[model samples]
Target: LFSQVPLVEIDGIELTQTRAILSYLAAKYNLHGKDLKETFRIDMYADGTLDLMLMVALAVFKTPEEKEKSLALMVKKDKTQNFPIFEKILKEHGEDFLVGNKFSWADIQLLEAILMVEELDASVLSDFPLLKEFKTRINNIPTIKKFLHPGSHRKPPPDSHHVEYRF
Candidate 1:
């Protein structure tokens, strides 16, 4: 979908951040919320979450001791805080999609977030039924489902073990 409408051709706009690209695509494709303020709020939250997840990934790549400390903190934050927030959002939205009951970029961002976190710590998902359900639900979407299948381009089972924490 994005490739068909490359960012370069969209008024010659350039976006340095993934979140910016997402926002631009959302607005361009009418996937954003009804109002600008709501769209801004959703984008801000999505970007913040992505930033935190990036930090967690960085920590996972650190030295052994640092990785242990980082992962411990991540486990705490993910379980006690982040996961619950996602659960609430999904429940509040009452739809598989994230914002305004549509298949918006926020949903894609969140699906990637869950997949990345699971890769880092497979056990991290065990306790979050909502998150697990959400992942399963998102993976069932037609476009996403095709990519999640065994022979698909975006399959997760293959590369997941490469970064398996030995701790």
Candidate 2:
């Protein structure tokens, strides 16, 4: 059984890998853009989202001191280096969603990554008003609210390597 997470079954077809499955569903459901190039752009943003998540994951696997050091390096990199790209994207889009001005998989992917960072340090996003607004708009949507409500379902128990800390 393909019980691994990110598994999706549609019309007797099984899908694996979060990004591949999401892109497929977006195309099938008409959630993606009208043009091929737009889809590529969305994929680019999604890739950036995955990169941020990977940075978060990197810290999770290290010893406590290493985790602290890693996170410190991550924060320094985030605060001084990369957030401007996201902030600029938000301003350029000038809408609730990232590309094509509608809710799409890129928005979902980035939002998920942002929330992960928030769990580490909510203040990080406060420095970027547009990003903060982007998060708020996504979070306040009726569908998103219902899907992510606190009581909806239990998250899996923390694994042995899980480390909880705050900045």
Question: What is the number of backbone collisions in each predicted candidate, taken in the order shown?
Answer: 0, 0
With a 3 Å backbone cut-off (N, CA, C), the pairs that clash in candidate 1 are none
User: Over the stretch 54-116, how does candidate 2's per-residue lDDT look in tens digits?
Assistant: 676666567768877876776666666656777888788687778888777788777777777
- Give all TM-scores, in the order shown: 0.69, 0.78
Residue 102 CA displacement from its true place in model 2, Å? 1.2
**Residue 76's lDDT in candidate 2:** 65
lDDT of 1 by residue, 1-167 (tens): 35322233357655545556766777887767777776776686577578757666566357778876876776677777887888887777677666766666667677777876777688877877777887888888897887777876763432224457332
Task: Give RMSD (Å) of candidate 2 vs. truth.
Answer: 4.7
Best by lDDT: 2
